[model samples]
Target: MGRGGGRGGGGGRLAFVVAMVVMTEMTWGLGDVHTSVATVAQLVEAEHAVIFALKDYVRKEESRLETIKRYIWGWQDGRADYVHNPINSYHFLRRLTHDFDSVRRALHHEDLTQALRANITSLRGGVEAAAEADVNGAAYSLVRLQDTYNLTVDELVEGDIRGTKAVQELSADDCFRLGQQSFNNLEFDLSDKWYQKGLELMEAKQPITHEEQLRIKRIKQQQEHRILMRQLVTNMAKQSDGQMLDRFSGLGIPISFQRQIYAQHKDVAQVEQLDDYYRRLCRGEQLQPPEAFVGLKCSYVFGKGGYRWLMPLKVELRWDDPLILVYHDVLSEAETELVKRISTPRLATTMVHSFTTHQARRSLARVGKTAWVRRGDDRTTDRILQRVEDMTGLATDTSEDFHVLNYGIGGHYDAHVDFFDLDEKSLDKSPHQGDRLATVLFYLNDVEAGGSTVFPMLGVEVPARRGSALFWFNMKRSGKGDYRTLHAACPVLLGEKWIANLWIHEWGQELRWPCTRDPED
Candidate 1:
């Protein structure tokens, strides 16, 4: 299972594609059958929907292709350095690259159904690999992908925004805040739109302050720079096909490189440079850092945690937040499949009790479902848990039951701490162990779009990777919930996100990691 094979032809994806096609055909046919004509706003709405839906997939396709191209060109390090499937990563990447090309072609077609079908077809290899590697999780993500694709198709065919509330309802501050958020997400067009809209909203409302005027001026200059930079990217991709050029335009490259050379035209030296550039971009390094660090004690350097367990593969240190280690193929395809299999049957919609409502409610902020895999309940999971304990140097019984979460579109947790507040009541009062001291998140599958575990205060965002683990301490050196750990699960814009969380308690591990009584440790 460790060695990758050709993409297996599975009935799972084909069946799903057929079902979605039929479902969407019926849903969208209603508009065409009727005499009602769609307004311009409807068309714009449909386009925006597609843009939001495909943003993540576009990000993934480019990132994976760049990574694979580097490896093929002998620039990338060993395979175990990143969290990826051993059985089908290369083949899946190859398939994704081709699929991306197909999508670009489909976008040119007049009939969007053709494009939607093409989009579903592109996922064939990925679906196969995902199903082969993680059965329950693969099915979960496939359904989510299909649903979003179908929705986009339906919107394109029959959807309308004519009757919806106008943008006039938004205040200047609302528009301003939204613009900032879009800018942070790298949606440049949307950011500019909101910024402009805020300026418009300012007219009927309060007078524009000096700061607001300066901000609007700066944003105008920045937007102009972005346009110039985009044009620079266009001139560089001289040899690329229209489809490939479209991708490069979206990649958000720096404008400083003035010369024109398509990606294919790069020499060995240029290839290395571009490889480094793409890697940094994919890791969110291009994202602007906040003005000040929130609650962070200090910056960290990457290194091993000095654990006793010996990993046969070359252990990689991908991050420095509390010794983040990524051991590839640590969980085999079979192991991942078994874990998902056990957890899926008991999956339940997670609920949070809001103090404002005083009632348990499902939140729009998060839509991920969860299930627990108790320790020693199954053979594969037992071994996995033992491995986890050894890896963390935590006592065998100190960790909580394995928590599997599935986050779909519009699913996110707003910026919040993971550790429970003693004084404040929790939303979901799940039966769990002591205060969470540390955590190890096993990224079950690579998300297609927007499922970054973002720590806004710390200015850190870790993309989820299959067969990889991200470990971090929830508490500071003084044994309190680190506000620096204030984080959120960004909304899944494109594909579903599957992850398993391992929470270690403060009940044990005195010998391994002793607590500090001092408040300012």
Candidate 2:
């Protein structure tokens, strides 16, 4: 079980060398595989893929190596950390050490194929033994094995040595340089290939240590996390409000908000009648906001600001009629419960930061968090738009547009105004017209402190509450602009919070809503 005895067979050593030379000749003869056809472009691509795979593998292997080494060293040094007496435990280590040695030998001889084959055999046995808990199974031997296998395959197929002299044959620096170039070009796939080849070379010379493996794993995890975030954002951009809300609900946060449905001038008469209409609208009855008047409100802040302050209220006048609604909460009890379930300390902070950074948006609208297209089929999002149309007594074909943003602690939208000013040429390529007219934001939960939607120039601080919404117009009725809509998410302090936003764009202006443009335009 120890490295005390060496294999005393010359036959084995001779066989290994012969196998290496034959394989090298075979690969080289595969039509300038190592030179003529080894264009920088093809080699670079292959090298990158190999590098990423090997980097991942090396990381895992290093972790297992650490565990095994620690145990062995501890036992040898008479440290209390080592546990003996279990024959199975010793057997596991024996196999693991053997595999390690095999890998070392293959690498030293520059024979990746043989090394990999031996490593895989050792790993399979090691994994099975570890799974059965017959040995010290705390080590993640399987992960290492899989990564190594993948890396070896990639390197074998893509690596090459070039130059007039053997001395200039593919150096480790050359492979790594190519890999770095691919990474710089955002060619992740290619970059990974080269890294793998470099790893193969390193492996042949010396195996990576445990600490190195840990560092590499963290790097890969970070990269993967970023990729996932980007994809999620892209998906969010394509969804309707209802769909977005439903997706948010699935993540365990619910939203509730109040919508203002203006009455038609002809439908208005006595003050009592107007009161009744308003009551009906609040009860979810069909009533539309007036076409002549615009509806506006303020939504919750994404992050917790440093200071607690009441939001400054403002009213915009159109023909002597005010069109904005201020102060409201956006979360339902069910939603609150869901938020409580999934709002972790780290997640809360991340959400809050994302919102404050303008990674999230807020708005007001009418709609259930979950819009169902068919029984058991959940897919509609324009419930707020439908409500607006119904209440206003307008007849435009309405569609749902919605979004759910998670604002954990420290969530803030840096400072941005939402308006799009794409030229005619750009408009032709856009999906939605530059028509974001108004925005509605609903605060799903309240933080213990901090969290406010701040308007710096106006010196206003709109606080967050359950079921409260803040609405505002980003675009004027004349299709012009309004500068007052510029806002930011203050930082969060304690407790977790949630919010849902709806950006109401003029028909065909959805594309513009998501883009940045001059508010004045």
* Candidate that would win on lDDT: 1
* Per-candidate TM-score against the hidden true structure: 0.43, 0.31
lDDT per prediction?
0.53, 0.40
Cα error, residue 170 of model 2, in Å, equals 48
Q: Over the stretch 286-354, how does candidate 2's per-residue lDDT look in tens digits? A: 444356234333334322223213432232222212133443322346644443343322222112212
Q: Report the C-alpha lDDT of model 1 over 313-337, residue by residue, as the tens digit.
A: 3345534554445555557766777
Candidate 2 local Cα displacement, residue 10, angstroms = 30
What is the Cα-based lDDT of residue 504 in candidate 2? Answer: 53
In model 1, which runs have C-alpha deviations exceeding 4 angstroms? 1-285, 288-327, 353-360, 423-433
Model 1, C-alpha of 265: deviation from truth (Å): 54
